[model samples]
Target: MAAKRILLLAGDFVEDYEIMVPFQMLTMVGHTVHAVSPGKAAGDQIATAIHDFEGHQTYTEKRGHNFTLNAAYADVKEADYDALLIPGGRAPEQLGTDASVLDLVRAFAAAGKPIAAVCHGPQLLAAAGVIAGRKISAYPACRAEVILAGADYATLPMDGAVTDGPFVTGPAWPAHPAWIAQFLTLLGTRIEP
Candidate 1:
């Protein structure tokens, strides 16, 4: 298959795992992943908001990841990509609503491309007016917003992500594996082991 180009969106305080895992996952399967953030520089890796089972807060190294100017949101032509993946965290709530992000989301959906959104990531879809009548799962805090946007919400295994038609969603960070698998399978690419 030709290179599968996928867009990964991020912003301030994004869950570190949510952003990294999917990027790693899709790349492992020979997909070209672009990490796009609203910041001028590649955004800093942030600490996870939730505590560990032992009650310790976890943090990540501040290594800079890829920034969006490389594929500036304003230039996200839908035909260039096979799909779009939005990893959830505070990022989507923060970045998803940005006019550029919203515009790309609408453009991707309108072009009939597949979209995978996790946690608060769906808010981008809602803001882009693309979630109406779709069944999705997201962080509990986003349930009301999803429904308000005309979607049916469901709770899924913290380890499992769900795919509905062209849209794929997962409840939280731990669901990255399922999120990645669903997208790759939908994209029909095999990971190069």
Candidate 2:
């Protein structure tokens, strides 16, 4: 399988598992994955948050590891990557409003690239106005935003994922197994045992 160059969007306080796991897994599978944050340079580290569901009305957040960027956001060009990844976390809440970030997301959508998002990552999609008319799954709290963006909100199990055309989405990190698998399929990545 040809290794695809993937661009991963990240920011301060991004979900720990959401960003870390996908970056590692995608790279492990022979894909060239570049994790980047706006106005950040390569080697700069961003803080991460660990979100857990422990019988609370909302998930609890804790400080997580620092994730370093392998690429510079200033150097990003939509055509450089074959796919886009947006991991859930508080970061999306902040990144969603960044005009540059939104524009990049829109470029990926216009190009019909394979895009994968988990949890609040869909927030970026909504803000970019790309998920409209598409079926998308995101963290429960983001359901309203999904609908507001004109996308059909997919009610999926925490471990479930859904794919609509060039997009693949999941509720949270727990759905990584399904989310990443579907994305791999979309990227034409064949994992032969």
Candidate 3:
């Protein structure tokens, strides 16, 4: 398979597994994954949050590992990458408000490049105004936002994933296996068993 250059959008309080797993897994499969966050440079770290469902009304948050970024956000050019990966977490709440981040998402969308967003990552897409008329699957709590953005919000199992045109989304981290698999396919990557 041809090596693809993937851009990952992340920020402080990003989900630990959501960012780390995809970064490592995609790189292991011969892709060059550059992870970046606004105002952060290479070697800069973002604190991650671990969300666990321990019979609570909502998932509980805990401090997670610090994730070292490999790329600087200011240095990224949308044309240099084959696809974009947006991981879900509290980060999206802030990332959605960045003009640069929204512009980046718009560039990927206009280019028809594959874009993968899991959990709250779609919040960025909504903020960028790119999901209109697309079918999206995100964390259940995001249903109203997804619908308000003019996308069809799909109610999916916790481990479910959905792909509509150039966009791929999942409910949350548990859907990573399927989410990544679908995205790899979109990137024209073949993993031989």
Query: Which residue ranges in model 3 land beyond 4 Å of their true spot?
Result: none
Global Cα lDDT for candidate 2: 0.97
lDDT of 2 by residue, 1-193 (tens): 9999999998999999999999999999999999999989999999999999999999999999999999999999999999999999999989987999999999999999999999999999999999999999999999999999999999999999999999999999999999999999999999998
Instruction: Give residue 168's lDDT in candidate 2 (0 to 100).
Output: 99
True-vs-predicted CA distance for residue 100, candidate 3, Å: 0.8
Put the candidates in TM-score order, highest first.
2, 3, 1
Pick by TM-score: 1 or 3, better one: 3
lDDT of 3 by residue, 42-69 (tens): 9999999998778978788899999999
For candidate 1, list the clashing residue pairs, or say none: none
TM-score of every candidate: 0.81, 0.99, 0.99
Clashes of 2: 0
Residue lDDT tens for model 1, 7-65: 87667556666777777767765788776665443333333333122433432234334
Q: Against the unseen true structure, what C-alpha lDDT does each candidate score?
A: 0.72, 0.97, 0.95
RMSDs, each prediction? Answer: 4.1, 0.5, 0.6
